[model samples]
Structures are given as C-alpha cells and as structure tokens.
Target chain A: MTIPDTVEAREAVDLLDRTRALVQPELRGACDTLPGPMRRVAMYHFGWEEADGTPAAGAGGKAVRPALVLAACQALGGDPDRAVRAAAAVELAHNFTLLHDDVIDEDVTRRHRPTAWTVFGTADAVLAGDAMLALAVRLLAEDPWPRSAEASARLSDCVIELCAGQQIDCAFEERPPEEVTPEECIGMATAKTGALLGASCAIGALYAGAGEREVRAMDAFGREAGLAFQFIDDLIGIWGDPERTGKPAGADLAARKKSLPVVAALASGTRAGAELAELYRGPMGAAAVARAADAVERAGGRDWAQSQAAERMSKAVGELARAVPDLGAAGGLLSLAEFVTRRNR
Target chain B: MTIPDTVEAREAVDLLDRTRALVQPELRGACDTLPGPMRRVAMYHFGWEEADGTPAAGAGGKAVRPALVLAACQALGGDPDRAVRAAAAVELAHNFTLLHDDVIDEDVTRRHRPTAWTVFGTADAVLAGDAMLALAVRLLAEDPWPRSAEASARLSDCVIELCAGQQIDCAFEERPPEEVTPEECIGMATAKTGALLGASCAIGALYAGAGEREVRAMDAFGREAGLAFQFIDDLIGIWGDPERTGKPAGADLAARKKSLPVVAALASGTRAGAELAELYRGPMGAAAVARAADAVERAGGRDWAQSQAAERMSKAVGELARAVPDLGAAGGLLSLAEFVTRRNR
Candidate 1:
C-alpha cells in the first residue's frame, strides 16, 4: 500500500508496514519453534492462521511497540536492522499478555476476531501464553548483541510490573467503585499499558549503545505516550463510532469496567458522579449504559481524561526532545508516538 | 538435622539441607523484589508466610532440583557457590509451574495447606505465577556468572517444553482411559518432569565451565533419573502407605488419572486389563477403586513399572559415569538420583 505525505499518519503507517516486513518473519520463526499445540494457538492469536489451521489475512496488532523499538534505535544513530529481533521479542511479550489478559478479563473479541481463549480452551490459551513468554526471553538470551542480557533483565522486570498492574486491576474490579481513587487507577494504567512500551524503547536504546541518561529519557517518552494512548483508548471505549471501532457504544460501562474515565467520574464530587456509582452497582441495560455515559460526561470525567491525555502527550514530546535534541533526526519516533494517541479507535 | 552414614538416603538428605540453606536466601531476595500483591501470593505459596501476611515456618519444597544443580556442579569439580543463583532460579521456575498446575488441576491442597488459588483466588495465583516466571529469568539475566546467558536460554527452552508437557497432560485427561498409550504417558512425564531437572543439571555444568559433552551427559543423567522418579512416584500414587504419602489409598484411581501404570494396564492384552478399562469408564467409589487397583496389579503394570524404574536408574548411573569418569567423584549426584526414586511418596 502506498503511503503518501498527504495523510497525517502516512509516515507512521509506512514505518509500521516496513516494521511488519522486518519483524513478522522473526516473530513467525520464533513461534514456529513452539510445540505443535502451542504453535497453533499462538498462530491463531497472531492472526497468522485460522482456527482450522488454514492461513488467514493476518489481522494482528499494528506493530506500534515494534515501531517504537526500531525508531528509538534509529533516533540514537543506531542501525534499526540490528534491532529487529529485539522488536520481535517485544511484540511476542505484548501478545503473551494479551492472551492471558483475555482469559483473566473474559474478553470475547480482540482485533476483530474471537479471543484465543474463546476459540481454544482457557487452559490451552494460558499454556500458549506461557510458551510465548519463554520464547520471548529465549530470543533475547540467545541474541549475539552485547546488550542482550540487560535487555532481557529489563524485559523480565517490565513483565513483572505488568503482572502487578493486572493483579491490581482485577482487585479493583472486586471493590466498590466509590472506594477506588483516580490516582490508583492511573498507577495501574501506567504499569499495565505503559510498561511494555517503555521497555521496547529502553531495549532499543540499549541496542543503540546509548548512555544511561539517554535510555532513561527514551523510556519515559514511550511510557508517557503509552499513557496518552490508553486515555484515548478509554475514551474510544465509551464514545467511539461502532462502524470504526467495531465495538458497541459504552460497552465498558455496560460491563461496569473501572476504566480511567469511569473512575474519574466516580470521584468527581458531583451529583452525576453519585448517579454513575449507583449505575455501576448492578447490572445495566442499554438505557442505563447511555445514562452512565452521560453521567460521566456531566461529572467532568470526559473533560478530565481529555486534558490528561493532552498533558501526557506534551510530556512525552518533552522527554523525546531530551533524548534527541535534534528533533529532525527523530521524526519516526515522534510520528509513531503521535500516531498511537491520535487514533480515533 | 543429623544425617548418619548408616541410612541409605542420609547423604542426599544432607545435601538437600545444605542446598536449602544456600538457595533460600537468593529465592527470598528475588521474591522480595516483587510487587506487594504478587509478593504476598508468592510468599504464601512458598510456605514462608501465612495467608494473612504473618510469618510462618517455611514448609516449602525439599529443594530437589536445586540440590541436583549443586551436586552436578560438585560432581564436575566446580564450585557449587557460583551456581546458587541458578539453582534458585530453577526452584522459582518449578514453583511457578506448581502454582499454575494447582489452578489448572483445581487441586485444593499443597504442602498440607490450602493452595494459593484456593486461598487468594485463581486470578491472583495466575498473576503470581506469571511474575515468578519472569523473576526466574531475571535472576539469571542479572547474574554475574560468565555462562548466565546460556543458562537463561536453556532454562527458557526447558520451560517451553514444560508447557508442552503440561498441555499434553491436560489433553490426556480429557481422553478415554484406553485411548492414552503407555508410551505417550512416559513421553509426557519426560517432558513435564524430566526437562526441568535436566536443565538444572545442564546449567550447573555450565556454571562449572564444563565442556559441552559433559553437560549433555549430566543432562541425560538427570533426565533418566527424573523418569525413574516419576515411575516410582506413580507407584506410590497407587500402592504406597497413605500415612507416608499424605494421600488416600487408590487416589489416582479415584480421580481416574491416566497414570503410567494405569495406561500400562489398559494397554496390556489380558482379562484384567479389560476389567480395569471397564472400571475406568465411570466414577469409582471406594470399593471400585480397590478392585481397579487389584486389576492393575493382576495386569502386570506393577512389575513393569518397577522394572522400568530400575532400568532408568541404571541408565542414569551410566550417564553420570560418562560425565564424571570415576563414580567416586559423583557420590553426591548419585545419592540424589537414588533418593528421589527411592522415596515411598
């Protein structure tokens, strides 16, 4: 597909297409080494194959995390080609979380397909996820790169944070909405969503042989951008167009999810916030979902999330500038960060 | 604990106690770095603390895998001290599997206490297990040892095999009793149980700076011994004293578990084999379980398993001799191999 400069995200989209060209083979090769059952589940999860073992039009992720890795490496004047394996490893780790998260959250649809757990049994999905995680670590451990050990350690630490994020998120769901503070919600989002993105950039920087200060800055950039992306994603979850998102309107509210906006609304100290809390207390019909969405908007949740996302994007750009003073040299990283948060879906 | 020379397994018992002393601090230090929620779950699972966050006497595992690591290092004339971190990493990986297996199998008890899942919930247990897997990798990645990277790679590969073994085992549980062959059962046992033990010994050899050939031999020794250990464990599952085993008599039959002996009996071309198959078709009460056990014995499964264990033990000794040249130099490893398969439980 031709990506012209006429589109705002054309550069990022072109970079993603190129990243897929480079990293997909690595990802597929690593997954191919898994046992037959796990390989099938992983292939299906990545949209490389249908449930019947037939090839499919791969509807896998957008390769955003991998794009960050390559772009971050290139931004530091490092060869992006040398970081393809690292990029693939990050993608595998990301998908591993997705597989297990779908099981934990009981999510049915992902990337416009039935979730792996819904297609395969829960046990199979979990085991396949386990294999992917080990595969990810193995990829780094076996890398000939000088920084592979540090990359592996950082990746492992990032996954532990991701687990903590997931554990806290689950615990939050079991508690009353009014009892959960917005600060805790943001902390969870940072760990759950921001961590892998940060690790991708940090690993890329390590591959670049960047100094500690530069690596730290690159990590912060990706993390802040990731949080911004999550905020936008939460907004889309509530108010996105069904035609574009392929999700029912207010589906998160219908499930009583303690999402960023929902939690913000619950703590807004307004009558609408009380109403939103009451709605979250029991099963919700479509009408109730619409009311909850309206309540969130009236309680200043929608505005707060919008401002926070914009603030996070600015912070991300500042951190990127810290690492790459000549912004012209970091166009790809900037474009990718902007592209993730700018998506309407 | 006094370990007298007269007792058959005294040397092995002494080695395990020393291994626990050396590896427990490393294990605890790694667990201490986990996030609060995951740390709590892990501590409880390891019998380091009670469910309520108070300290408890550590009734954790017997340090069998770690003991093998140290002993293998000693057998190859290497300093066992250098491999303590690797040993701890292996133990962490093993416990990670135990946590997930309990959740998957829905087993309610572990180490005479309620399982982590039963106490905390499946979500927490699963997250905690995921954290531990990453922690295991992280420990090796952060090690200062020259061969830490290779060890990490081997451990990760072993975990992938472990997942395959577990996946196959769960698949077998869903099939008919007569459908699972004895060979398939043994293969699963090797993959599930033998792979980690093999990796442990191989890593120990690596830490010792042993050549590849010696490492391979050490791994084979551990694998054969692990298979023998499984055979003996399967026997104890059926005919051992419940008081010693901490399980009820005929428990495997009560659950209709397609264990090695059970599969061997079902595959035997005898009247008793047919009788056992018929009994396996439905839930077995106490009397039916007793009759099924008697039929397994009549079908020659007992003798076959006993002989198989002895044969594997002989192979394990041969492999050890190949690695160490002089059998006297490998007393520690030999004692460990003997101790595992010789246990009544």
Candidate 2:
C-alpha cells in the first residue's frame, strides 16, 4: 500500500481537480441567495473574480483536504461520489479558516491579490467567513451519508477545536518569548491545522462504514500527516524558494513568527537560543530576519526542524500502515502524505 | 393552562438569572485560555468586567434567548436540564453575533462600555467572536439531546442563515439607500434575527418529541415573535428612554441606520421620506436625528412599525395556539412571547 514516490502525486492532484469541478458549481449556487456584496466577496475569495468583482479564473488553492477525503472513502471501499458533498464541506471549511487566518495574521495579499479583508473590510470578511462555516456545516447535514448524525457531529467538533486552536495560536503571539515551547507549538498546530484534516479522513471512513477502530486509525494518520505538513511548512517559511513560496525568503523570520524551528531553537537553550531571543525581542526587519535565520541555521535549528519533520512523516506513514494495510488506493494516500510533508511549495 | 398576568415579570427574570449563574462560569473558563487582552475584551463584552478585566457586578445583559429555550422545553413537556446546554448554545450564538455586529457597525459602545474592538483592537474582537461561534456549535453537537442528530443539523442550518442575514445587512449598509426596500429589510431581519430564535424553539420542541407539525408550528411562532421583537426594537431605537436603553434616544437615527420603520418611510416616498433621504444623504448630527425622528413620527413610520409589531405578535400567538393548544406548562412560553414583543427596555 505504500506509495514509492511523486509519480502518484499528479494522480492525486487530478482526483482533487475532478472533485473541485463537481463541487464548485454547487458551492457557487449556494451563495447565489446571499446579498450581492457578500456573495461577490465570497466569489472573489473562492477565486472566481477580481477584487472589483470582475470575472476571473483560478482564485482557489489546492483542494488537498477534499482529495484526501474522497481518496480515503474510496480506499475504504465506498463510492467517492457518495462522499462528494462531505469533501466539498471539508474544503469549504478549510478555505473559510484561511480567509479568517489571513485577516487575523494581517496578511494583505493572498493568491497575488488583496485579501478579502483588505478589499471588502474586516467586518465583511468576518461575516463572509462565518457564512462559509455555516455553509460547510449545512452541506454536511444535507448530504446523504450513512450515520449522517455522527458525521455532522464530527465536523462540528473539528470546527470547535479549530477555533480553540486558533485562539491558542493568537494567545501565543502575545505571550513573552519564554512561554512558547516546541511542545506548545506542536499542540497548537495539531489543533489548528491537524484537527480538521484528521476529522476529514475519519468522517470519510465513517461514511464508508469503517468500524470504530479503523476510523480512529485514519484519524491518527491524518493527524500525523497534518503535523508533518505543518513542520515542513515552518521549514519552508524560512528557506523556501521565492518562486515556489510566492513570498520573500525568510518571511516568517521577518514577521518574527514563533514557528516550530524557532521554538525548538529556543528550547535548545544554546548560543543560538540567546541570539534568537534577542532578535525576537527587537523589531524585526529584513536585515534582522537574515541575521536570525543565519544564527538559527548555525545553531542547528534548521537541522532540528528537519529531524522533527522526518519523525512526524514516519509517524504519519506508520499510522496509515495501521489504518489500511491492504487497500490498493492506500498507495495514493501515502504518496499524497509524503508530498504534503516534503513539498517545497 | 395560560399563566396569569398576575405572575410578575420578575418570575421570568429569576429563571434567566439562575441560567446565567450556571453558564457564566463555563463561559469564563473558555475565555480564560485566551491572551490577557483578549480575555479582558471578551469579559467586557460579556458584561463581566471593566475594559481592563477588573471584576465587576451586574454587567451582563438579560439572558433572554436561553430563557426562551428553557421555557419552550418545559412548556413542550421536556426536561429543562436536557435543554440547558442547547440553551447556553443559543445564548452564546446570540452574543457571538452581537460582538461581530458591533464590529461591523463600528459602534464604539456596547452595554455602556467601550466595544471589544475599540478596547482590544479589531483583530482580537474578530477572533473572539469566531471562537464563541465555534464554541456555540460544539455545545449543541456535544449536548446529549433525545434527537441529537436532528438538533445538530437544525442548529447548523440556523447558523448559516444567520451568517447570511448578517451579510445581507452589511451589504445594505454600503449600497445607496434607495436600493434597499422595506421587504428586503424584513427579509434580512428574518434571516439574521428570526432564524436562531426559531431554531431555539424548534430544538426545544424536537427534544420534547413534538411531531414535525408541532415543530413547524413552534418555528413559525418563534419567527413571528422574532419579527415582532425586531419591530418593537425599531420602535425603541427611536424613542426609548435613554436610562433603560443604555444609549441616547434615537440612536439608530443618529447613526442613520436603515431600520424597518425608516425603510417603510423611505418606500412611501412621502414628505417624511424626503426629509429622511435628505438627512441620510449627509452626516447625521444630533439636530438631524431629532428632525428625522420628528419627521418619521409625523409621517406615520412609528405607527406603521407599531402596527406591524401587533400583526406579528398576533401571528406568533396563532402559531402557538396551533402548536400547543392545551397550553400546560407552555403557559410560560406564551407569556414570554408577549413579553418579548412588548418590552420597553
């Protein structure tokens, strides 16, 4: 069941693309009843328009969560179409979080244009996010999944934890540098990023009539995958190619984001930790970010983050191994997991 | 089984007082996990503390929505405790909307204190509101109602419509005033204000094993009551006592808010409409608000709102009559509806 390399990555992407084509129209139809401005803002965020509401193409990101959902359902011996609504629900929830996250993080640009908050105002963005969250839940509820009640409940639980995780993240931002730990960072990432992905897989399995044990295993697999995904993300934040990342190199360092690598470095309590702390305490600039990045690299922070990513990747594969030992579709999932954790973009 | 008017309003207040006591601790526990500034801002919005988070007494508003939920359950022959979590869920959802509404409206004050965004910054307020919304949904999903699945689905539907309603509301604010109509305003109010209230009553009825017909009737009752509530609120917004309202009289007019009454007057295109259009076209100062209020009063806006309130109250009562004809403990519910639509405060 193990996927050997990136060959299957393109297939996974194709599956995701097909899923998006099926769901995008439905998603747009749901918003048609909304007020014009709100609908326009949502359409813009969903990559259907320019900020001025002019028609456009390609506003959405990779529909990774939905792909995982449909693949897991198929791998578990269920028709992927039966889980299409659920897949769309998870994707909508993911994008809703992204929209809010952009505003909360004060990120002005997304997908090479102004963020929703910048164009429509934060108030409008807040309402739009709320609307999308509600829509996600409704989509799940309306879908004809087996054990619909349980699946709906699972989705709601993930949303709640997602919010709590976000709260924990924002709370961490304001704390003195000493309060942040690698463990705390991981905990936040698991809740904020991992919980929904895990729930997506678990719910898909549940819909496929997977037993409780298998569901739990899939949950663990997705959670581990999410952690690995985030660890790699943290790494890329510092050292990713500008062309791939679409941001300046070392953007995380420039923003003084207390990411996994920085937390690990500080936890090491080495010379790098002292220098990192001083850099964090001061106003972060381009020069400061470069210096801090160099210091962390010199002090083994990058190596530590890489090791953590490798460890989590192994754990993710281990969980998938336990969850689905003999399924042919498992290869694609494993390959996708690897791609998620190792991709430079 | 109708409760006698001899039963004082204090009796209803006492039930809410007790429910508040039970929920306040839980709400505070959730907020405590946030950063210091966020916690303080949330506390202030909850009427728990000053802007700085110092402990204060008698700061919270009436827990009306929770009380309605509990009362509806008891009246419909269900255990109030079984509905308590849902009650808290509805209340939290209501407050979550309030927090975001304050931000969207850019109101500097709420419950006679600096608004959460004004005190904690807009980012914090948005995050806090989003967190509360997530918590509300979680409470409903986790609460072990007799029909937990149905209840969860119902709640999710309500939240989505509520968000849509808010979107419509914000959209209206930016458009040319002429583009908005009284019918559109009512539609927005029904979605934004009526949906959750209707869901609360419907959930209560569902818990009580009320058949679909009964649930539909109760939903209608709640929706009518909610519309009535808004109509009366519009009346109060222009003329209620400042001491009771915690704001100056005619605050909505002061802000040029397009409430139902104003929309009605504007749609009439009479002398009052002309005056209102003039005042709304420019910045509304104290004199303008006073003049507009006088014009509305003269042009029958106030009377028209009152008449609409009466019609809605009658419709709500009729729905209640069909839903629970025997009355029984639902006596309290009937009284609660009347009280909600008639309250001066």
Candidate 3:
C-alpha cells in the first residue's frame, strides 16, 4: 500500500487517501439513516460491511471524485474544511449511479465482491441506490451555507445528465455496432463519466465562494480530466491485468462493450477493424476475447486512446491554469489529473 | 367534470382543479430539461402525450398531494403563489414514486393507459423515474426562497421513507398472508403513502413561513389523512367497480395483495378469518376472489378498515384544527379529507 517515492505520486496519494479517510465516516454516517434492511445493502456496496453485517476490510473505490472536490477547494485558496460535505455528497451520488448501473447492466461483481443485488436482491439494490441519491441531495441541502441551493441544483442537473447517459448506453446495446456513432458514444461518456466529476469540482468551487467564471473553469478542468480517466479506464477494461482491475481479462471485449477504444478501432475501417467487427458480431469465447484485444491493438485503438488521454490531460491542466493563475498551490490537482491518465490499472 | 352543487364539494373540487392547473405548466417546464428519450417517456407517463408525438387527452393522477400543498399554504395565511413551486415539486415526487412502483410491481396499466414500462421498456421507465426525482429536487433548489433547502430536505427524507416502504412492500409479497402482520402492513403503508403526503403539507407550511409547531401539526394532519386515503384505496381495490377504478374486478384480491382490509381480516381470529386464510393459501380464481371478498367482510375486516379510516379522518381534522384554530378558511382541507374517506372508488 505504500506509494512510490516520486513527488507527484506522494502528493496524489496523500490527497486521495486523506480525502477518503475524511469522507468515510461521513459516508457511513449517512447510511445510518437508511432503513435496517437497506442499510445492510448500502453498507456492503460501500465495502464497509459484509453481507452478514460483520466488519471486514474491503477495497472501496479509489475516492478520486472526492479528492478532486477537496483539492479544487484548496487550490482556489479557500478552506477545504468548508467543502467536506460537498465532497461526501459527490461521493454518495457517484455510488448511487454505480449501484443502479450494476443492476441495469446485470453485473454480479464489483470491487472484488458480489454486487448489492446479488447479496440482497434487485428490489433492495434499487431502493438502496435511490436512498443514496436522496441522501446525497439531503447532505447538500442540510448544509446551512448560503449557496446550498445552487450546489444542490448543480448536483441534480449532473444526475439528470448521468441518467441520460445511462439511457443512451442501454439503448446502444439494442442497436448494431455500426449504427452507434463515435460522437454519440463520446457524448454518452461525457454525460456519464464527466458530468459528476465536473459537478464535484463546481460544487467545491461554489463552496469556496469562487466567482462564476472560476467555478465554470474548475468544472471544465474536471470534465476534461474525467474524459481522460474514462479513456484510460476503457483501455484497462480491455488490457489491464485481471488481478489489478478486479475483473476478468478483456472483460469489456468479452461483453462487446462499445467503449471508446473499441469504437475508434471499429470506425478506423482497417483490415483488423473489419475483422474485429466480424468477431464482435458473434458470441465471444476466451479465444475470441484474446483475438479481439489483439485486433483492437492492431487497428491502432490502443494508440489512439493513449494519445487522446494525453491530449485531454493537457486540456485539463490548461483549464486548471486558467482558473488558478498562480499554479503553485495546484500541485494536488495537477498531479491528480496526471495520475488519472497515466495509471496502469 | 362538473362538481356537485354542494358547497363543500364545490370548494374542494375548485381548489383541487385549480392547483392541478397551476402545477401542470411547471411540470411540463421541468420535463423540458430532460433529454429527448427520457423526456418522451416521462411525458407519456404523465399522460401528456401518447406513444407517438401526438398530444393525447390522457387522465393523469388526481393531484391530491398538490392540492394538500396549496390548501395548507393558503390555510396558513400565505400567498399560494409563493408556494406554487412547492406544490409542483411534491406532485413531481409523487409521480416519480408511481412510475417506479409500476415498474417494480410490474403493473401494465395506470390511469387506464399502458404503464411507461410496457411502452418504453423497464430501463427507460426506471431512468425516467430517476430523472423525475432529480427534477423534483431541482425545482425546490432552484427556488430563491429562503426555505428551499428545508423543503428539499423534507422531500428527500420523505422519499427515503417511501423507498423503505416499497422495499418492505416487495418483501411482504414473498411472505404468506398469515405471516404478514397488520401492524407491519400499516407501518409500510405509512412509510409508503403517508410520508410524502406529510411532507407535502409540511412543505407548504414551510413555504408559508409557519412556526415550527404549525409545521409539525400540518405534517401530522397530512399523515393522518394519507393513512385514511390508503385504507379507503385498499377497500376500493378489492370491491370497487372495475369501470370506475380502471382495473379488473377484485384486482387486489386476485393479485393476492396483502392490503389493509385483507390483512385485518386475516388477523381477526374469527371463524370467517380462518376460512379466509384457508382460501388465501391457494391460487385465486374469480370464484375464489368473490368468496375471499365475502369472507373478508364476514370476518369484520371490511368494518375494521372502515372504522379505522373514520378514526384517522377525525385525527386529521383535529390536527388541522390545532394548526389553524379559526377553521374558517380551512374548509378546503377538511372537505378534501372527507372526500378521501367517503369516495366509493
């Protein structure tokens, strides 16, 4: 669990770990308000408890969004303490989507454990996700800050977009791969992955009492970084080690997921791209998954995804620079953005 | 539809219809913010449009909760104009629950029309419901009024309870009728049905700038009335004319729903109760449904539910009296409560 000795790694790990530690108690406290049965489902989903209500060490999410919230607040020369509630709210909202998405996608496992639906049931998982969303809005509204209304509105709007993204993603499953455009896929990814991250940064900046322009700049910064994060995540879905990613090898390809890299490769129209399309049209086995990964690489999907990540990293950093002119106090934000794109897993 | 010439009925219908008219535009405005597909699903669910793009004169819900909101606001000596947003927000939240409940219950019809899931599919229905909920919270938060945070928090908390209620309701379906206690059924009904109604009145009171005691009394009033509403609804579900109810005859009994009256009958411990329990242990046909209805009545379940509704009605009136001592301008709320318990269907 020790972070590397590099300055950027140390800073990124410190900020992320610190934010997770700070937000864990708040998240657990929020779950306390759920009904008895639902509380168990939510607690298990958050990796705070086992299905039997026994305490267990668990690998929760990386708490990346929360780190961005607090780091944005601090980078804006504001008291990060004032934005703790906002950070927790963002994390709660993020987990809400995760729980429901698991149900919608019918995925049985998450974070190296059975998903909440498997542990409890579909009804319980759905309700737990719903309660988590309500709790997120409640947390923001309960904060007596002057701009609580604005923050809540922003969070709700982001949630609406997230729902829209998920709807389109589900709809794409009904369409032929050729019928799914790259522009549509990218828009869905932005709405699904980028919106919440953008809202997190914007909420933090709002709590920091930043001007509108600054808050928007922070939102843009987070949106770009979130896209980079998703691009890298899509790559990891196709190529990362199963042990590190906590999923099967080439899980996205096995499922024929219309991820960015796969879509780009399909759109490339190369010989490998055509072969990959033919393979995707059939049921996938171990060999098919392996061949699919090779074809994606041969069609330049991996390179395209990698370069786009780098491009998005620069765009994100530029946004952060625009928002915070000094850049001296932005080490955490800048390192976090770099870590998002460059992390192997 | 034309209301009766009676003074009480006229006033009640006027207020309810007026509130619906006022809230309709705001609801449409809110849906405009949703994405295209989701917006269409939501609009269809709300009876604003048919499956195609053509407009349809569909029958939406009765807008009972919105009526309570506006009535409470006016009875509290506040300008109802200031509380229009709160009324619309409550209606939005109520419909959000309905859309999800239909999906969860797998009900194919609502308001004499096809349920959203049957038309658009379950995923779209669920996402549309999620969008509706987010829109509810957004409506409250977008209000510049000082109590927007309080109203939003109340709505969210009520939604949490509603989810808990639904979770228990689904769980009850897995249990035998004899195993489902009347008390448990009542608690679930309160959480599912009473909480939002209570929140509705409390929201109105908050927007009215009422004192803490007044707000609490208003909430109590709505909770009592909401229980009575459910009790009456359970009765109608079992025995109401199918044409009026827009459902099959003896729908609840045929579905083996553990409604209040049926649960009360099972808990009666009379000879007819035992016979009814025996009948309920097997699958229900038309003859069985008819026999079960007779058995329920003979076991005093029908009487018990009726008397309980009356008791709750008085309690609601008492709470309203406590909140508004004059009871002069409170005729609208009192009449609405009377109509809830007295309606045949």
The reply for model 1, stretches above 4 Å from the true place, is A1-8, A282-287, B1-8
lDDT of 3 by residue, B166-279 (tens): 999999988888888889999998999889889988888898899999999999999999999999999888888887666788899998889999999998888988988998
Candidate 1, residue A273: CA error in Å?
A: 1.9
Which residue pairs in candidate 3 collide? none
Model 1 quality (TM-score): 0.97
Candidate 3's residue-wise lDDT over A98-198, tens digit each?
98889888989898789999889888988898899999999988998887788899999999999999999999999878567667888998999989888
Candidates arranged by lDDT, highest first? 1, 3, 2
Deviation in angstroms for A75 in model 1? 0.7
RMSD of each: 2.0, 4.2, 1.9
How accurately is candidate 3 docked according to DockQ?
0.86
Residue A94, candidate 1: Cα error in Å is 0.8
| Backbone clash count, each prediction separately | 0, 1, 0
Better structure of 1 and 3 per DockQ: 1
Task: Give per-residue CA lDDT, model 1, range B1-345, as digits (tens).
Answer: 223343548888888989999999999989989999899999999999999999999747889999999999988999999999999999999998999889888899987799999999988999899999999999999998989999999999999999999999999988988889999999999999999989999999998999999999999999999999999999988898888776899888898989899999999989999999999887799999999999999999999999999999999999998999998989998888888887755
The candidate 3 chain B region of ten consecutive residues with least summed lDDT is B1-10
Q: Which model is ahead, 1 or 3, in terms of lDDT?
A: 1
